[model samples]
Target: MAWTKYQLFLAGLMLTTGSLNTLSAKWADTFSAEGCHGDKEHEFSHPFVQAVGMFLGEFSCLLVFHLLLCHDRRRPVPTVNPGQSFNPLLFLAPAMCDMTATSIMYVALSMTSASSFQMLRGAVIIFTGLLSVAFLGRRLKPSQWAGILITILGLIVVGMADFINLSGREEHRLSDIITGDLLIIMAQVIVAVQMVLEEKFVYKHDVHPLKAVGTEGLFGFTVLSLLLIPFYFIPVGEFTGNPRNVLEDALDAFCQIGQKPLIMLALLGNTVSIAFFNFAGISVTKEISATTRMVLDSLRTLVIWAVSLAVGWEQFMGLQVLGFLVLLSGTALYNGLHRPLLARIPCCAAWVLDDAEEQASAAERERLLANNRVVQAGDDA
Candidate 1:
C-alpha cells in the first residue's frame, strides 16, 4: 500500500523522536553540576532520575489518550470501546520490566557513546526472536536464523571496534565502554521479556494502544519513583562521584538538575520526545506494516550515529560502519524483507517458502501485526 502524507509524517516523527530519546539522555549525562553535599562538581549520572523523566513522558500519553477518547466519543461511532474492561494492575509486571531495562540502558548510556548505545539496541531483535521460540512456541524460518547469526557477528564487530580505539592511557575508559555495551545487551533480554509479557497477557484483552502505553507509564513511574527513596540509602562502589556515595542519590540528582539548565532541557526533551515517539510508532504500525516500522527503526540508528559524529561525540570508525551495514542487513533479512533477493539465489532458494508456507507466514505476520498495533508503543520498555 502506498503511504499517505499523514502516514509519512508519522514515520518521520517516529524517527526523529526516537533518536532524541537516546540522544537527550546521553546529553544530560555529559554535564557537570554541583553536588548535593558540597560545592564540588560531579557529572550528571542520574540514570534513575532520567528514567523517571522517561516515565513521566510516557504518563503524558495518558493525557493524550483521554483527549483522543473524548474526541472519539463525540463521533457517531466511537473508536474506543468504553465497555472494555481489564484491571489496570495487569500492567504491573511489564512496567517493572520497563523500569529495569530503561534504567540500566540509561546507566549504560552514561558510560558509552550515543552512537554505540543506539546501534547496540538492535540486539533486542535477537533476544526477542529467541524468547519467542522458547516461551511462545514459535518456530523460526531459516532466513530468520541467518539474520540472528549475522546480527551476533555485527555486535562482536562493533564491540571490537570500540576496543581497538582504546589507548593504553585510556584503559579505564575502555573498561567503561565494554561494560556499558554488555549491560545494554543484557537489558535487551529484559526488554524481550516485556514484549512477550505484553503479547501474552495485555494484548489479549484488545486494549487500546494509547491506554496500554499510558497505563504502563503510570505504573512504571509510580513504582520507580518510590524505589528512588530506597536507592538513596543503598551504597555502590562505582558511581560514587555523587554526594552520598550511594547507588542513586535522588537528592543529588535533583540538585544537579536544578543547577544545570542544559541538563534540565535535555531531560525535558527526553521526556517529551518519548511520548511523541510512542504515538508515531503506534500510528506507523496501524497505517503501514510492521516491516516498515522495523525499517524506520534501523534508519533511526543511522540518524543517531550520524548526528553523534556531526556533533563530535565520537570519532568515526570504518569498522563500526561495516558493522552497522551488517546489522541492517540482518534486521531486514530477519523480517523477511529480503525474500526477493533470497529467491534470486540458486542454492538459497529453498529458504524462500513455497505457496503453502508463504500463506501461513503471511497470516501469522498479520496476526502479529494486529497485536503489534496494540503493544508496539508500550514496548518502548
Candidate 2:
C-alpha cells in the first residue's frame, strides 16, 4: 500500500527517535566505560549526576527551541501554556517516577554492559501492557496477547542468558551483576507507571509533549537535587562494587566534570542527546500511540547492541542474539506488522480472517445506523 503523508511523517519521527536514543546510549556508555573512555575520564560514574545533567539538558532544549524556533505562532509545533493546561504540581509525581527510573538505569549501566542494559529494557513493553490492562481497563486483542506471550518468552531467554553468564563468574562479581540486572528491571517498572500516568492524565489535558517533558525536567531536577543534599552530608548508600560513598562521590563527580575535558564533553553530549531523544519519545506517544513508541524503541536496542559489540564493551553471545530477535519479532507483531505475512500461512490465517470479518460487521452496523437515521428524519418531516 502507498504510504500516506501522515505515515511518512511518523516514519521520519520513528527514525529520529531510534537514532537519537541509540546515540544517547552510546554516549552514556562512553562517558562511564573505563576501557573506552580515554585517559581523561572522570568520577561521573554516579547515575545521579547523569540524571541531573539530562534534566538540565531537557529544560534547556525546550527553552532554546521555544525562543529560537517557536516564536512564529503560525508554525506547527506543540506550544505549551502551562498556566491554562494543567496544574504544575500534577507533574511532580510522574517526574519523581522518571527520576527514580532514570537514575537506577544509569547505575545499572555502570554495573552491567551496555548491550545487557539495552536488552533488559525490552521488558518495559511487557510491563506497560500488563499495567494498561489492570489500571487503565484496556482489553487486549488476541494478537496483542500473543505478542505479550512471545515477549515474556523472550524475557525468559534473556534472563537465562544472564544466569548462564553469571555462573562462570566469581561469587562476589556474580552477585553484583544480578543486583544490577534487578535494578534495571525495577527501573522498567517505574517507567511503565510513568508512561501509563502520562497517557491517562497528561495526554488528556492536551499538554504538548514538549511542555510536558519540560515540566517533568523541571520537577525532576529540583526534587533530585534537593534529595541529594542529605547525600552530600551523610552516606545514605554505596554503589555495591564501586567505592562510591554518596557524599564523596557526588563531590568527586562535580570536580571531575570541571577537570576533565572529555568527561565534560561527554556529559554535555549525553545531556543534549537525552533531551532530544526524550522529547521525540513523548512526541511519538502523543502523535501516534504509546504502543508504537515502545515498538520503535526496540530499534534503539539494536543500535546499542551493535555499538556495544563494535566498541568491545560486550562480546558476542548466542543467547543474547536469540533473545534480541525474539523480542524484536514480538514487538513488531504487536504493532500489526505480522498480519500480512501470517495471513499467507494456513495455520495463522484464521486470526486474520476473523479480524476482517469483525471489521466488516462493524462497517455494516454503521451503515444501518446511518440509513435508520435518514428514514427517521423523513418520517419526522
In candidate 1, what are the lDDT values of residues 1-381, reduced to their tens digit? Answer: 677899989999999999999889988888998966666888888899999989999988988988988999899978866447899888999999999999999989988888888888889889999999999888888878999999998999888888886756477788898999999999999999999999888887868788899999999899999999999899887764576678888888778878887888999999999999999998899999887899888998888898888988899899999989988988887888987676788876776658338769888997999788769767875
* Candidate 2: C-alpha lDDT: 0.71
> Candidate 2, 178: how far from true, in Å?
1.3
C-alpha lDDT of residue 262 in model 1: 83
Q: How many clashes does the backbone of model 1 have?
A: 0
What are the lDDT scores of the predictions, listed in order? 0.88, 0.71
Q: Please give each candidate's TM-score.
A: 0.90, 0.77
Q: List runs of model 2 lying over 4 Å from the truth.
A: 1-43, 68-70, 74-84, 236-244, 279-295, 342-381
